[model samples]
Target: MSRPMNDPRFAPLNLALEEALSRGLGSGFALGVRTQGGERFQTCLGLAQRVPTPEGLTPKHRFDLASLTKVLLTTPAVLALAAAGKLDLDDPLATHLPDVYQYDPNHPVRRVTLRQCLTHTSGLPAVEPIYTWGEGKARLEALVLQKDWAFGESVYSDINFILLGIVIERLTGQSLAALAEEAGFAVTPGPSLAVATEACSWRGRMVKGEVHDENAFALGGIAGHAGLFGTLDAVLNRADALVFGAALPPAARAAMLEKQTDDRALGWQIRHLNWSGGGLSSARSVGHTGFTGTGVWADTERGITWALLGNRVHPTRHTDVRAHHQFRQRIGNLVQGIFAN
Candidate 1:
């Protein structure tokens, strides 16, 4: 399914990524584009890290795949578990994660369903500083279930995936790292070879080859929401799986890409107005982005999957978010042009 290097079609993509590099989207990036027909190509450019001795980027450089873990790992893991008859998507989270506020059966946390969590309608806050509050991963995670914060309409929450992680572990009796490794993630990339993301004030050093999310870092460097590091191929292969891999039941795979709620699917977000996937994204397209400036989008209708892996947070994350979207949109539309015929 691999194409020869230097395909003429990739020239425009190279120029686009080069322009992004010039604009400081990231010190470096690795992008992969593949068609369902098995045509594949990539463009890797810029420096992986700007601080310390400079290192040039290469296709082998693993990037910290931040929130991509939700779709590329957690959602698929949940589907696989369901296919294996370990759990049901409609089952309450407490059905799998029994310790989720177990003391009070009447707790609202007990009523949240796995499907609701997958669809980001679980009534949990978008985020909480569980990392700052607790001493241990277990204690911090337990706070998510027990914390009596005001819950309103459903919101995207890292806690949802954290709970999903707990459920997966409880059901499989295996660590997430082990499962992630099996799922084709390079969970523990060497710091020397991994792309650097930030000059973290908390960690007192440049964050490279380690997770940047404070909560995922606090959770012993593995969580359902983040802490995944992977190669560009790994990201693309998973995107390929979501679109066509038979590893999950057809119904489960369909659910992952279809609109499960509003514009959101199980974990991926379907293309919508003004979405970063761009104007060219068809209704069958789904994608997700990461805090570390990584993204993957696949269009079933177009038979194309593309990923952009970058260290946009390097040095700092205090940049205009809109600019990132504009860049992604520009590239998404351009990628679509490849199959316009």
Candidate 2:
């Protein structure tokens, strides 16, 4: 049989998670760890609320998954297309979505390439309130195309993935949401696993379970940047398939996981050196973080992965200070120790 969640090696991680929750780190959180050999350690804490419920936050509970949608849903499709020889990583944006550049005479969008988008070097604005436009997909696409695209410092930008999603849809003739499901994601209605994120200033309602990213929500809850949602197990299971080459061919998996740029694979954020989302235990790690107090990191070196899902944005998005970061690091450290033993 496998080890229990309370194994002494995991004590530090459990203690850290508990302490963080007690200190109001998040409304609730769930964590699951799987080793290379499939050894596992899982834990949950707090509640779906500050109070409690029968189905309180557990390892299976799905969280918003925030920006992780970029890597989880969007990037995978890009990789898949590349694997099929239908797309090129270095291909210019103008090749697929020529209109994005045509709409802007000042700064042509054609200059952007898939490689730049994946590496956050596309020079697109980090984010914009696209919901304010209240436009349809065509108009939204026009608005995005009209934006300037130039080289910039290394900073993550949602617009990169936003446009990337559009490219995927246009090339595959499939909606981002539909493609994710076909890629083996267990996406369900928002109210099922997800909790409400924000009662937005624009769309005045409690944005429950649906994607909390306004631009993505504006794009109809399935964008290359954010919208997809699923349980921790479901997401991890997908990761397992990628790592073990279940859905993708072995060569394709290698290509997907291969380091292309600094600390980044095709659709994954690499953890070889000490980047972010935790450290060395994060080495050999390829995972992503969500803005809404959620993250997933898998260390292929140790054959272990961890998923931390929480409604940190619940009630308010900015209330928590460093609790979530601390919690993630603590969890990473704890998981590392578990593998050490």
Candidate 3:
């Protein structure tokens, strides 16, 4: 029988996480670990806010989930569409986004494919100041469409996933949020008691229940690169599905998990030394970290899924992430011990 609760050995994991929180590594965090054999654990620690009023972190408070949006929303949509024969990874951008490609002065846009974007080999710059560069979504997107492509190494550009989101939107004719729902996920659907994130000058206040990425904000808070928000359970459920063959078809899952770039899967990130997933994950383990102190990692070989969500940027974006990284490593070590036979 599967133990749906924590074992005493799990105490060290919780203590390390709580100590990190107490040290202000983040304002608060929610963590969950699950294995196929039914071993499970979850815990929350710290405050959701500290300046104006204190709100305790709970299992239910949604996190910003910055870049995890790629895995949680865009990637699955791409794989599901591929599985359903609705789109092809190798299809030219012109096939779905003809107007944007044809009018762009940069002809490279025409040659870019969903596959390159997914794999971050499309040569899109790692990031562009589109939020400040333009006035509206059209202008911002057009700016991206006109940028040059190098098409060689893995660049890990937000622009790549942003384009993927656009592709998904154009092909589906539905908002990314709607498609996320269709895929059994949710974005920042509405105002809620979400964990607070950066207190940005752009938004000019404490950011809560809204995205923290300025670019995604400029794009109406539903872009491929960021702008997802969800509870710990929502994230773990998605991670579990992805790892255990529930969310994606076998081929799609394989393709997504396959190392397209040295350290990157289709939309998820593969483990590397000192990565947030830490050293215990197998090479096949896949995960992504968010800027707002959130991440999800799955070790398929071990049937383990771990989610850590927090408002590390609660009052500002200047928080150093090294502590968060170390916390993950400690938790990873503890998990390794628990799963050791």
Writing each residue's lDDT as its tens digit, candidate 2 over 1-341 gives 33457766666777777787777767677777777777665667777654223235655556677787887778777878888888898898887877766755445468778988988877777888887776787787787776655555657888889888988998889888788777655343656555555556666666666777777777777678787677767667777777764667777778777887777887678875544456657456787788877788777777777777777776567766576776677677766766744
Off by over 4 Å in 3: 1-7, 104-106, 147-153, 189-191
What lDDT does model 3 reach?
0.79
Better of 1 and 2 by lDDT: 1
Ranking by TM-score: 1, 3, 2
Task: Candidate 1: count the clashes.
Answer: 0
Query: For candidate 1, which ten residues in a row score worst on lDDT?
Result: 1-10
lDDT of model 1, residue 192: 73
Cα lDDT computed for each candidate against the true fold: 0.85, 0.72, 0.79
TM-score of 2: 0.89
Name the top lDDT candidate. Answer: 1
* Candidate 3 least-lDDT 10 residues: 1-10
Query: How does residue 23 of candidate 3 score in lDDT?
Result: 80
- Model 1, 1-341: lDDT tens per residue? 45533778767777888888888888998878887678787778899889876889888888999999999989999988988888999999778777777788878888889999898898888988778887678877777666775678888888889889888887889989998898788675768789998898988998888888988988878898998999898899878977777757898898777777768998888998898788997889999999889999998887899998888898799876788888888889988887544
For model 3, name the residue pairs that clash.
Answer: none
